[model samples]
Target: MEVQLEQNEKKGKAFIDKDGKTLAEMTFSMAGTKQLIIDHTEVSDELRGMGAGRQLLQKIVDMAREESLKIIPLCPYAKSVFDKDDSIQDVLRQ
Candidate 1:
């Protein structure tokens, strides 16, 4: 599944769509140009336990790195993922 992105002005999301239905997504707000405020994440029942949340997080993480930006994981799930994973911490905003 490919992660798609949609953004307008202040907010945006990294999402996966399967046959026109969203399977998973991570939403965020643009914090100026140097930071991203990741505020929420959700996965469909079909994607539960399949790492869909992480997948969406990774997509945003990669975007952050590419843009030389940091991420503040305000969402509980996103914060939990950032807490457990040391490898992705480079893009995290402390």
Candidate 2:
């Protein structure tokens, strides 16, 4: 499945799968002008071990790079990814 992103001013979500069934999803809330607080991440049982959660985080990281925004990974999953990847330090909120 391909990850897709949707966002407005206050919030955003990265998700995947077809039809109305969401195979996985990660959500974030806007913080001030240049940061996003990742608050939630979920992957369906059938999609587990498929790296769907990582895919969503990667998409969010790409979006953050494109928009020049920092990430405050409040969600444990997201924070773990950020902690393990040094390359994402540029966009990590200090």
Candidate 3:
């Protein structure tokens, strides 16, 4: 599955679309130039248990790394992932 990303000055999302419907999404807002505040994550039943949510989050994490930004995972799913993954801590906001 391919993940897509869209962002503006204040907020953004990484998501997957299938046949004109969204299957998974992770939403976040920009805090200044250095922080991305993850606020929500969801996956459709078809994509549940298939790591769709993690794929969307991974897109955001990749962007954070390229842009030199920090991620503040306010959403429960995102927070849990960050808490468990030591390898991705480089982009996590402490």
Give the candidate number with the greatest TM-score: 3
lDDT of 2 by residue, 1-94 (tens): 8999999989999999778788899999999988999999999998999899999999999999999999999999999998998988899988
Ranking by lDDT: 3, 2, 1
Query: Candidate 3, residues 1-94: lDDT per residue as tens digits?
Result: 9999999999999999999999899999999999989999999999999999889989999999999999999999999999999989999988
Q: Native-vs-model 2 lDDT?
A: 0.94
The numbered model that scores best in lDDT is 3
- Compared with the true structure, what per-residue lDDT tens digits does model 1 show for residues 1-94? 7898888878999999999999899999999989989999999999899888998999999988888999999999999999999999999987
List the RMSD of every prediction in angstroms.
0.9, 0.9, 0.5
Off by over 4 Å in 2: none
Q: List the residue pairs that clash in candidate 1.
A: none
Please report, in order, the local distance difference test score of every candidate based on alpha carbons.
0.92, 0.94, 0.95
Off by over 4 Å in 1: none
Model 1 worst lDDT run, 10 consecutive residues: 1-10
Clashes found in each candidate (C-alpha, N, C closer than 3 A): 0, 0, 0
